[model samples]
Target: MSERTRIPPLSPFEEQAGFTRALRAGNRIVVSGNVGVEEDGSVSPDAGKQADRCFALIREYVEQLGGRMDDVVRVRMFVTDIADADAVTAAFSRALGHVRPTGTLVAIAALYHPSWKVEIEAEAIVGDE
Candidate 1:
């Protein structure tokens, strides 16, 4: 049987719901929904800015767990407005560059915070164990 492992909990906020921020099994890492809250826990306004912040948080989690952005294989972006799709994609492209992981953009009614415009989740493969 394949053994399963869970990544260390990483949350900028003290009040978190019932969900791990990330999990690792062997060589693969799966990151949960990440928002655009700043280090001080302040969210950004613009979609592009929020997207950037989300990716930054995701990157931090990956690096903390001994993984790199290059290892990312999939990404999911959730936005409050469909009109912000281009901005979100542009921000993602800038962050991921040519890695070009498989991605999906979704429109949602709302998120945890009213100021938050975007949230991101990701999955990465480190290597075969």
Candidate 2:
């Protein structure tokens, strides 16, 4: 049987809302959608900036669990504005350019927060260190 692990969300509200930031089983790790909102509850206005923050959060969680950005095998992006695609993807690419994980980008009608232009999710696999 494979082992399972859970990484708690950064905020108590997230815990109360019924979800964690990430979950892992064996070598596979799945991170929940991450927004640019910081610990102080501040969000960026630009999609690119938001993407940067999201990737940082995901990278942190992945590394904490014994994995690296290069280990990421898949990525998904939820973008509020189609025009912001370039900015969002640019940030995503910068974060995983060498790794180049399989990915998809979606233009959504809106997000939980109107100011949030983008949210990102990532999946990674740990292989022999």
Candidate 3:
């Protein structure tokens, strides 16, 4: 069995909630739901920009766990407002459209934070590159 590796929690709630930001085991990498909270803990009011932040963090965590964004096989996106779908989709295209990873986007009621409009999660296989 391959050893498990983890990317330490980026959010304070992760440790308290007993979850990791990302994990790698064998050839697979899984990233937890990522919100648009900036480095300073402030979130953008723009949905597209928020989506952009989520993808950026996902890419960073994926790479840190020994996988490239190109290796990502699937992605799941959640948005609190259906109206924000277009903006979120545009951001996703900009971030990972070239990789052509399968994706699912769904409209939800609300996020853990009322201000957060979107959240994203990703899965990658190291050898996919």
Candidate 4:
């Protein structure tokens, strides 16, 4: 059996705090909750834009682990306001398109950032050769 490997994100927040952003075990990759913060740790303006940024960050981690967006099997979205669901879904659909993965959306009071409207976490599977 091959040993599990962890693919940590290179975020200053995580790096300074000594934590990994994601872990890869065998053919599965589990990503930590990702906020819509840019590489410089700035949150976007609104839910729709944040949703798009979240997916962009997720895609970065997914590709790092030898997988694509289509390889994602599950996703969890956290939103501060229920009213943003439609906008969030629209952004999500634009990113994932027909590759609909199992998803869950929850309304939360707030996120790590004051302006962050959405946060996402995901899991993907890479088939063994």
Candidate 5:
């Protein structure tokens, strides 16, 4: 079995929820739902801006796990409002267009925080890369 590695989350919720933000087993890395909220607890109401922040945080985790954005093979996005799909898609494309990873968008009733508008998760493979 490959050794599993994990990264701490920016929020205390990770501990409360009993989960890590990122995990790696061998060359495969899995990133948990990344929200747009900053370390200072500020959240961007705009879906696009929120998506941007989520993607950036995911990228940081990927790199920390010995991978790159280009290594991302799958992406999942969650939004509170379906109308914000365009904004979320635009931000996702802007960040990972060249990678062209398989993606899914989901509409959820709510999130951990009331003000949060978007969240994202990703999977990456970086075998010997």
Candidate 6:
């Protein structure tokens, strides 16, 4: 069996909800949906900034589970408004343009939090390069 590892979440709700921030099984890593909220519970009002934070957190978790951004093969982004798509795309480009992973962006009605404009998730394969 492939060894499995769980990367602890930065959010308290994750522990209470019985989910991890990320999981690694052998060479593959999957990061859960991440919001733009900070460690202190502060969130940016700007959609771009929030998306940026989500990507940052995703990168961090991927690395923690022994993967690089370049190994990320797929990403899914959920935005509360279609108008924010441009800003979120800009942020995604800034974060993963070099990796150029396959991605999907869809406008959703809302997130768990009212202030969250975007949520992101990632999947990566270690040493895929």
Tens-place lDDT digits, model 1, residues 16-93: 665778877778888988888888877667889889988988888888777899999999999999999999999999
Per-residue accuracy of model 5 over 1-129 as CA lDDT, tens digit each: 999999866568678988989999998999988889876879888999999999999999999888999999999999999999999999999999999999999999999888899999999999645
Q: Compared with the true structure, what per-residue lDDT tens digits does model 6 show for residues 1-129?
A: 888899766668777989888999989999989999987889999999999999999989988887889999999999999999999999999999998999999999999889999999999998865
| Runs with alpha carbons beyond 4 Å of true place in candidate 4 | 15-18
Candidate 1 TM-score over all chains jointly: 0.87
lDDT tens per residue, model 2, 60-101:
999888889999999999999999999999998899988989
Q: Which consecutive 10 residues in model 3 have the weakest lDDT in total?
A: 8-17
Q: Model 6 residue 104 lDDT? A: 100
TM-score of 5: 0.93
Per lDDT, the best of the predicted structures is 3
Residue-by-residue lDDT tens digits, candidate 4, 1-129: 667676764758787887777777888888888778777767767789889988998898888888888888898999999999998888878888678888889999998767889888999888733
lDDT for model 2: 0.91
Worst 10 residues of 2 by lDDT: 6-15
> Candidate 3 at 106: error in angstroms?
0.3
lDDT of 3 at 33: 89
**lDDT (10s digit) by residue, model 3, range 1-129:** 888899876668777888888999999999988899999989999999999999999999999988899999999999999999999999999989999999999999999889899999999999853
lDDT of model number 1 = 0.85
The best candidate in terms of TM-score: 3
Off by over 4 Å in 6: none
The 0-to-1 C-alpha lDDT of every candidate, in the order given, reads: 0.85, 0.91, 0.92, 0.84, 0.92, 0.92
Candidate 1 ranges with C-alpha deviation above 4 Å: 1-7, 10-16
Note each model's CA RMSD in angstroms.
2.5, 1.6, 1.2, 2.2, 1.5, 1.2
TM-score of each: 0.87, 0.92, 0.95, 0.87, 0.93, 0.94
